[model samples]
Target: MTDIIIDGGTLTASRQDRVVRGLLLPYREECRSNIGRFSFAPGVVEIPQDLTGMSLNIEHERERVVGAVTELRETPAGILATFSIAKTPAGDAALSDIEAGRRVHLSAEVAGVKVKDGKGIAGSLFAAGLVEKPAFPSATLLAAEDTSDDEDDPQGGDDTETTHSESEYVDEDGNVWRMVVDTETETDGDTTTTTTTVVEEVTENPDETTDTEEEEDPMPATLAAKAKTPTPPRGRTRQRPSIADDLPTLYATVAQARAGDQQALTLLAALTDTKISGTGALPGAGVLQESWQGQLWQGKSYDRKYINQGTLGTNISAAGKSGFKMARGTKASPKTKLGGDWAGNKTELPTGTANAEKFGSTLARWAFAGDIAREFFDLPGGAELIEAMFRLIAEDYAIWSDEKALATFLKLAGAPVAPKTYPSEYNDSLGMLLQGILAVKRAKDEPSFAIVNSTAYEQLLYTPHEKVPEFVSFDITTELRGTADAGKVYVVEAADSYFVDADDDPLVDEGEPAVLVGAKAGVEFDELGEVPFTIDALEIAKGGVDRATHGYLQTFEIRPESFVLIGSAPVVGG
Candidate 1:
């Protein structure tokens, strides 16, 4: 009987003569026999088939089975095997050839085969796709291998045992088995020795098997590859709705408002009240003058008339002892009189005075009045009124001083003028006073004092006197008018005129006789005499040409006076 020794962990078988039959065989038949509950560890497994004295060649180009065969078993039906295959050209080709029903035969004289746990035959055969159905039974079983001194034996002689607490499997013989081996190597001299030990448990029961799935990798998605698109950010929009469709109505409403429609004011008031607070007093408050105006008028109390008037109104005169005496005596007299008269006569005076007194009173009341009074009026205008009164006083003093200067100048100049009468000329002191008053008024009215003729006063002061012109006359004779061609040219004799000066020397005794020439062009003479002088042809031609008709000539001379040339030239075409 010829026994097929499969010393390698697993082996594959196929019928060489019938490829279809071999292909039809189950994969379990491809496993080695007597592999009994095998284990894969850190090292390799070797199975040697004795082909002594027999020539045998195995085609292992198919790569279905390569690298370490994880498990090998024999059953009643067929061989069962599993391998951890390597991706190599020869292994792939061997698997392919086996799957195609290529058969490998052992030697005729060869005995049964035995597999060892070693690096050489086990690693090479398994890497060559001789095994089927590879598996990793446990973490320990993942590194199991065989190493023994059995050179001739097909299987590696024996396996080195490992010490570990957890056993991966238990066989029918009650021996605990491990699945994985961790190998370590030591070399002494030229020989190298390797030792491997099982490290973890393994299980074959399908129900008890633990599935360890790898973690999911996080790969970045491209912008184009993402499934969902991102939404754009929200933008701000105007609160009001567009009036495009009702533009005409809107324009009509605006026009009506501009024309002072009452409804517009009502609408504005409503909108303002709702959208803006404290706008009710705006219209009335805008028209109200500042309290400072009143305060400024109060400052004018320093004036003699204003003070006198204030005294008269508030003072009580004692007709009996020593002329008139103040009711409050000398000390309080001025204060009482000024204050009382300011209060009483304020309404009778000019608006400026009344405003000033009102401002002063407002300030005084705020500063001196009881807290009860302050609370009653709320004192809102107190500070403003005080400021106004001070301004009014300052402005009034300025006006009074200017007027006083004018009065003094007028008295010195002997003008018995009343305060009401204003001077017109800038030379008068009264005029300066009026100017000051007018300037202040203009400043208040125009704010900028812009409409003043700045040079008027200077021009009035430096006006120049007009000079009188000297009168003289000359006579011309009919013989002096010598004629040339009527339309072309003519010559007028030059006439000389002179004015006698009493201071001038006699003509015979004169240093150089004063030459008198005619004002008309092209005529010259030494002295003014009754004699006729010759004129040029060009002058005669110029004199004959009408300025209106010739367009370029301006004037002509006719002895005594210059004449304006007029009349049009005859049209040649017409």
Candidate 2:
């Protein structure tokens, strides 16, 4: 009780790449499709050959489609006929179905057919309804048969033979006065006569010569399997892949890492953009940090040893006084002198190892669900997710480094910076900072950069300071540095200035916002390993459940003496 078509009609894929449907097909083959149920078998139907390249209203709608027969194959079920919608004005309506992966019924004019397996003339095929989708064929899969078998006959070529020829002639008057004559003369008493006949047929190639049962037999285990094209290969069509059925998958990078080979590591780098150097205890959050100059320090701290700014006192003291008289040849107490005094007095280096407060971050924000990890790996945005994680790790490292430096700064700035005397109260911040920068410039032998809060910067902006005329507000990374007034004052953001309380709430009054100053080498950022900033993941046993611990080890230092802040510095773990 569905719409029954006696001839050319729809087919259903047995799996992804195969289908068995045709006119005069065998069995009561049924298929599920969006177009509804459409059955095809031979009936008393007649299809005209003239309609082979013509259009038909297979849509069963207003528009008619030009149906072009793609192939008429002898299938295991029966004759499998496949057709495509021609590119025409009316065919567009039918093509929409094909493009949408929707099946359409084939309206065929079957004629002069009697039985289910009987063959007859099929006039035109029109796609009518919708159905499930199927896969297209590869070149080798469509191969039907081979036909490179035509060879020349043995005795059909040029060869000499001994024979005689005779002829009879009659007048146009129809009087049988036949005259007989020998047409061949004796070639040394031997003559040759040869006759050849050849017959060939001009076939339209309609018959399905290749009877493919079911694609092909699987390759045996004994032989190496390969693809082969038929000597008379079937035509291969280019069909786009179906996006709906495409399923993405996750690469087993984590599993591959177990191998620990160069190739495995390389693949991990390509996927995660990071290579594992070694494994150790992930550093805990603390005050001690490595500086940009790659040295260990606590806060805005530095190291200095007793170095003779100039030469100290001599290795021996003057053998004067009572010692000279009592002991003439004895070694005297050695002492070094300051610039204009005795050698005994010594002074410490201006800068010494001031602090070693631990400062770092522990990456603990993790979605403990393993399913989340799987999702990140399997989703289309997996690469982006991984990249974002890497960036956050770097940012976190920089942030903690900055905080440590700020803490050092708060300690170094005088107890009473005693608001400097200036024309405007607000504008005084600029003058105060300029005085600090001038000192840093003298010590470091180069001008330094500064960072302050937006409010402080606004104060500087209102300053009537005329010396910084060629000024512009821009970041250091801006490309047009040459055009900027290098001698003028500028500010950078103190990335780690904010502090939070135990509740993870930003503290309203930890201290005044900070202003940091640094030269290229003024701040030391000690790196612990070759790759200080790295991605780390591990499985931790917590509460009897396995959880992944993803963290970073970015060890760096920032000198506190280089920065100035208005508020108290945030302590570690704040």
C-alpha RMSD between model 1 and the true structure? 44.2
Give lDDT per model, in order: 0.25, 0.32
Candidate 1 worst ten-residue window by lDDT? 357-366
Identify the leading candidate in terms of lDDT.
2
Off by over 4 Å in 2: 1-337, 341-394, 408-416, 424-426, 441-447, 462-490, 495-520, 528-574
lDDT of 1 at 447: 12
Count of residue pairs whose backbone atoms collide, per candidate: 57, 59
lDDT of 1 by residue, 1-574 (tens): 1122221222232222211101101111122222221222222233324312121123222322333433322221112233333456644555465555342211111132222331112221222223223221111112222232222323444333221122233433322433222223333345444432322222233443343423322211111111222222222111111112334543564476568775432211001122222555544545655575433332223333111101111111222112222233243232333333334654664222111111101000001111122221235666564445444444444344333322222122221112233334323222332333343234332111111112222332232322101111122234432232212112222111111123321211112111111112211111112111222122243233111100010111112111111112223353
Q: Distance (Å) between predicted and true CA of 404, model 1?
A: 99
Please, what are the lDDT tens digits per residue for candidate 2 over residues 1-574?
0122322233322222222222223212322111222223332222333435533344333244444554443322233344554556645645555434464333333222121221222222322222222111110011121111223435554333221111121222221211111111111124333221111111122353442223323111110022222122222211112123111211243244345533333211001112223332235445337554422343532111111111112222122111111212223432232234344458544321222234431221211122135445446766565555454544444444455444433333323233345454335456555555655565543434555554455555555545342332333333211122455444554333333323445322343433434343333323223222333344333322222323222222233344333333344475
Which portions of model 1 show Cα errors greater than 4 Å? 5-88, 91-129, 134-177, 198-574
